[model samples]
Target: MPAVTVSDITTLARIPEPAPSAAERGVRSVTEAPTGFEGEGFPVRRAFAGVSHTDLDPFIHLDQMGEVEYAPGEPKGTAWHPHRGFETVTYIIDGTFEHADSHGGGGTITDGDTQWMTAGGGILHIERPPEALVASGGLFHGLQLWVNLPRALKLAPPRYQDLRAAESALLSTPDGGVLLRVIAGEVAGHAGPGATHTPMAMVHATISPGAQLRLPWRRDFNALVYVLSGAGSVGAERRPVRTGQLAVFGPGDVVTVAGAEHQDARHPALDVVVLGGAPIREPIAWGGPFVMNTRAEVLAAFEDFQAGRFGQIPAERVPHGDLGELPTQPA
Candidate 1:
């Protein structure tokens, strides 16, 4: 097969998005990520907890799409779907995820591990129940971020970045707060990870209950927070976020978070994700599982995937081991 171009996926994508002014870029004050997003056909259960590229950038959506706790044998996965032009990153904090795609690239993602897959040009894939997680019996928690590749890199090549827990840095604060720094330019005066293909801010933060933290953000980037475990407040404005909720900030160079009464020492584990990125102020054309700039380029990606262009298997030396088979749907 060649590749599936945008024409193959139809014009159902490229839906209009909100365009705030440049003045609205840096978020100093914080606010909730909202409850009801009208578009996107999936059941809008708060399961889709992601930050949309509403203003400062074109990073698209960042969903901390944690799974609902199901019984031992319930269906636990996403059906097969298609994507093109963009990329999907799966970061696991707990539980296991087995994934496969049209490219013959598939594997089991364990806790504290990450898989970066760029669906450049075109590709079809799915994510669902993992024999490992299903057997382990616990809540499934992770983040799936969509990073838009610049037009030049959109169709260049599909790639992967598999990071093990020890391979990355996990920073600690004096008050027992931990941050698993994954990607983007840099942090704490450290240089960029060189792991990510694009500049991004992806950190997993967990503070003991009642701890306070103040973090820096460049005046040029877009930033936000998603509360995972304990409940708390952030910023001088003091916005509250429970588990599974996102708090987006407006125009600020740094972020200040204060622990709340409920986040007392007794609770201890308060989980949160500190995520942000500088905006890619370029044209954006997105729909379904893919994202690209121009409609023509989108069509081209669809055609490539449909033609088997984007489905090439990774070489044996790439470290993914044997991925078994090409999956038309998620397993």
Candidate 2:
């Protein structure tokens, strides 16, 4: 395999048709993400889920949360909740978030940090804005992805990986116009620190004026790109995509994205996240916060949580550090 570099990504720049046997292809479909509320009335847009858009295999759910601004003391987040049989990847883009779980895991992740949590057997956790941030009132934006565990690892031990932004792999064009921050997997020989039971890649990219990128991906993995901000063109055909839209790809190992010039100067750059992974191709029994291979396992997860098997969080230990005046809800 050839090394993926800044120059390698621009092979199809300004081109119309991909060459015969080209590793990249055009877009298959462009769809809008569904908007909803979860985690104690926190607003989010669903990129995909097993209940709908079932083609994405190991990745069960993707949620793009509030890029929306909030008044002082109005931000909302989830209280303690139990999860089992899968993992949750939380990527913070613009704000601070505090985390606490039953496994004695806790941390404060600010801008550009990713928290990968695996709720293998069962784990109770809380995720929300810091109290201080709520008091100040500002923009809070990020992504939360639910990656399914294979049946073999469904009952594995719970764990957490905190990947800070400074530690992520940064990819840029030769002239420094385009920037890609890889949080997991590899690009141009630079790999993220996230350890995974299931192989996958997650990249956050920012495209400046007229910048372009061609990303090499695993041929066997299913891939999709979500437009987080501004407008841009994706794939070889340069299909136009806007914020809140998801571009699903066809069979190919590479995808191209270009930054388009926009009339609004306030939002000149394009922001996107690329994600891909191999299909688990196993039975999925999903309930509120649990994902298992069978309904019986899901039931057992609930019973374990109820029986105090997942552990407990002390009231004094709960994160009130930056909680501000916003009312907190129990999960």
Estimate candidate 1's alpha-carbon lDDT, on a 0 to 1 scale. Answer: 0.57
Task: Pick out the ten consecutive residues of candidate 2 with the lowest summed lDDT.
Answer: 322-331
Q: Which candidate is the best by TM-score?
A: 2
lDDT of the candidates, in the order given: 0.57, 0.78
In model 1, the runs with Cα more than 4 Å from the true position are 1-56, 135-137, 177-185, 191-194, 264-268, 312-331
**On a 0 to 100 scale, what is the lDDT of residue 294 in model 1?**
73
Q: Lowest-scoring 10 consecutive residues by lDDT in candidate 1?
A: 1-10
Residue 74 displacement (Å), model 1: 1.5
Residue 51: error of model 1 in Å?
6.8
Give lDDT for model 2.
Answer: 0.78
RMSD of each: 12.0, 5.9
lDDT of 1 by residue, 1-331 (tens): 0011123222222211122322223334333444432111211224223434565364666655444454576435564556766778777766667667767666777666677788775665556656655665555656677777777777756666666654544454444433334344565554323355556677666654566656666666667777756777776666666666666777765665555556544345567767767677788876455577877666665565556665543454234333333333212
Candidate 1 accuracy as TM-score: 0.73
